[model samples]
Target: MKSRFVTGTLVFMLVFGMTLAASAEVTLRHWDWHQPRMNIKLKYMAEYEALNPNVTFDTQVIGWDDYWTRLMSGVAGGDVPDIAQFHNSQTQAFLNHLEAFPADVFDYDRYKEEIINFEAAYLFDGTFHFYPVGIMSGLIFYNADYWEAAGLTEADIPKTWDDFVEIAKLLTKYDSAGDIQVAGFVPNGILGVFWLDLHYQLGGTLYGEGAKTVAWNNPAGIQALELIESMIFEDRVSEVGFLGFNEAMGTGHAGMAYSWSWLGGELDNNYPDLNWGVFRLPTFDGKLAPGPVARNNHETGMSVMRSVRQENKDAAFEFLRWLYEDTDYLIEVNLVLGTAPSNRTLLDDPRIAASPLISAIAEQVPYTNIPGEIPHEVENDYGLGMLQDLLFFGYPAADALATAEAEANSVLMERAVKWYVEDLYTPVTD
Candidate 1:
């Protein structure tokens, strides 16, 4: 077997062919919302600059909530950074403003096999836009101590929705005034994504008529909504009108939560004393589904903007090529974020495979799914907003889902017109 360094060197040569001599100095502006990984980015940038002394990076770290607004503003003004973070959700919204990865410079065909879920994660309109670094999948994190307290063990972990609800009920605790002291579960923490997962597990579809219409108003959707309602209301295992449920879980006030892989890192860093275990989301039945149980892919990637100069774009691509080929860098950055590395080769690294929590996250990578290319804001406005109503205001699941479906259909219609009609009407200047 080849050593790790030898393997990395071989991969590096296969990715970026014959290094060219640096001529003119170029400063590429790089932007990302992963503020937590700022130091890692800087470290990599320094190393990259050392490799090509003429190429430098101007890195900017923005907050997640404000990143979109800033990105949109930059896009409108034709001033986006040379390289920036690209979310799977925002791909449809900024498709026109982004630059497709040049096939000549980046050997996508060769590299695709090295990355996990490459086809599902980043391909759009027969073009690739981003270099995916890691993926964040939904996971059920339970406090092992709380599980033991409830007289449960690894063997007692839930295999079906019903079993999970039962386990949640047993783990719940109440205060003197009949208020919950410890929540058994927290479905509201990942409401929209969880709902989509449940919908798919129950054999539901989100799109209809060739993605031009919404089809989530069917029986499967209704059942998914009703289940969430029951969890928050009838079962009372999960508290209604509660936020920070994940934090509560970390503090031992909540027994279980349906959260993304990042929670594993958070627990490791913030609640080191808390014993936690992770499991894949239980299915509707007691069996694990053969494929993905969800529609949302929380994978994030880096992309070059169309507005950047060709020289700068080339520089940016060089850095990206090195970043993706460097297995150590990819693994380290992913470990910091508590996510599974998009580079499939690093998935089974000794460090990741040794840790049960990280290993559990890596296991779900193959079964993860990406959402349809819909406008990102539509889900937040129609899907998540309506679900919140059912949870906090006691709206009937049927009524809430119907209203949400109607609103979502309208949004889809608008998107259809923009893509099929309005875009055609606008003349292509280039």
Candidate 2:
């Protein structure tokens, strides 16, 4: 067998003749936090280079902690990679850096039907800025072994919020002297997932859907925040401060941890022997809960930068297209990154069928929705800051949420005015 590098080089040399233009030569700079999966990245990069020899890739891997800072600097400096990986939380920061998905760029309409359940993730106000990379759904993950040790069965899983609390109390373990041993449930300490989901379940609206006003201080909002406070103060489940989901899962300190599909990969890496399964978070008051859960999960997504040269744009877009349309490529990403694929067609892949964690997310697709894209500065910088203060810090939930709503409204109004002045906000289509 040929060495890996030689094999890769040969593969690309063969494909370069088919897809690459004679005069085209492009280089792409990509940044992502998958240092552990460099091999997988190299494999895909090699294949992509072969298909488009005229397009070359130069990658830079950054840890998730520093990646955002570096990415923000790149955006501010107007220097961005043609194709870069992005998280949902970071999507808002780069919206302005993305150009419309031009017809010359790709055939959106032809692939539209193939990309069901993706409109909210990539399309915004009639402008399509991203080829959505993956979709994430928040679910409660339970350790099967822990539940069994507690004499609980699959049928014992909670169906509603009240039921969940009771089950959590039951599964909670105490040492001989009555000291807490293991927690029954640990909600991921994310304001958006943990607190926001609670707020939605409690029937609170963060902002008026039309963006006309703030409305997070309603009864439901207070109720939701109070419930979270009680989970920490009253129930005394997990530790008081922010305990990361990864650490909670790795140590098996909690029977249940709320997280997205990413947890599947983490568990495999950190606790390979643990038997875990996922279930939907319980609803509030048992009215088949709505709001946050139903609102859509892809408000944050990756986008192709508009600043890249035309040739790199085409190559990067090609890679993105393959990622969405190819089954093997999609599965590889799911396996390596643990993020669910945005492409609807990949849902039924055999690989997903074999993995319960991935299948759980796939099964929820019909029920999933995207929050849709909004102005980045408003949602990312201003909104998340208020969220950190309200949820993470000890701020009164009502006042914190109310302030966040006001700040969000202010940002929206400012963007609207600018769009009007620059004539960039015109409705090109109905």
Candidate 3:
């Protein structure tokens, strides 16, 4: 009887161990900077957990301004999250710290065919570190009421830079003190892509052969800068040193501004009653250029950290696959986010194609240029500052652009040397 009792106890202990192992939980920590989209992500997270009961999510949404700083800190301290969202423009900065997604994580041929501009934006060093969440395009957002008040219609929308300035002059309003009460068009704040787009529109490229030289000091760039100068000084339609000019455009303080597709959603949500319309930015020669010439592609995506444990990495990748591959979920999330679809399939979906706003933005996809796959923040900052000097401090456009080119080139050369030494400068190939 004692021997029988011992055997039964052993069997019970074995069964208990098996149950504990089966119930073991795997938690994936995620980080993203888009605080407003947390609820949408959380809903999907809950759905994913329901499907895989053994997995759970620990998600944190940080403010955009502080996010990069925090992320770099985490990377430096070796406390990075399992998965994180990063801008495509900033991905080059974190390549060494990120884990390249395995072949099975996503089907390469299908992705290249289905995602718009994926190769230009996300493909890096012969592999993809992240899956794009959305594609954003630089666009012109105009206040419809203000445009009409200036006696302009859709038919009157400018088709060339000369026509644009003329319409802008008509839209300007001033206070008793000669201060700009309503700007015709504000070109100076936050939106950094204006000059870049203008450069491309004029048949200019930012980088030269081998992606190791800066080419913005050429004729195309000079013409772009001259036009911007003409707006601020010659036509006097746009003013310098105006803060929050982009937001003011929505409040009817401005007629038009260079902005992104995301601005439409923000205006709709924050000022639902405001009447606005979207348009492609005018070209220098009054003709649409082919192949991403008038717009800049600003896309963001998700990547897994190299430091995550094997089991957690598997769970994280599975979650990403489900997040991107599920058509219904992708549509719902993007609808809430109000971003252009990264998946080309969604671009053809009747749901997306039918929306006037989405259609308008999507139309620019083929004409947008993704900036070079190099560290560009420094270049952008320096160029913008030089631009401000031209607009606000009366620096010559030629001088400012030359200075910008020199400084930007210096940065590029330094980065190129470092990347080459580390064997990280493998350019993406067709």
- Pick the lDDT winner: 1
lDDT string for model 2 (95-178, tens) is 677766666656767656766454444555666776655566777888788888878887887767778877777777768986
TM-score of 2: 0.75
Clashing pairs in 1: none
Task: For candidate 3, list the clashing residue pairs, or say none.
Answer: 292-367, 292-368
The TM-score-based order of candidates, best leading, equals 3, 1, 2
User: Of the pair 2 and 3, which is ahead by lDDT?
Assistant: 3
What stretches of model 1 exceed 4 Å from their correct place? 1-21, 266-274, 417-430
Better of 1 and 2 by TM-score: 1
Model 2 bad stretches (over 4 Å): 1-24, 36-39, 68-79, 212-214, 233-236, 239-245, 285-296, 299-303, 372-430
Number of clashes in every candidate structure? 0, 4, 2
Residue-level lDDT of model 1, residues 24-94, one tens digit each, is: 78898988887767788888889888987888888898888899899999988887899988876676678
lDDT of 3: 0.73
Candidate lDDT scores, in order, read: 0.75, 0.64, 0.73
**C-alpha lDDT (0 to 100) for residue 211 of candidate 2:** 46
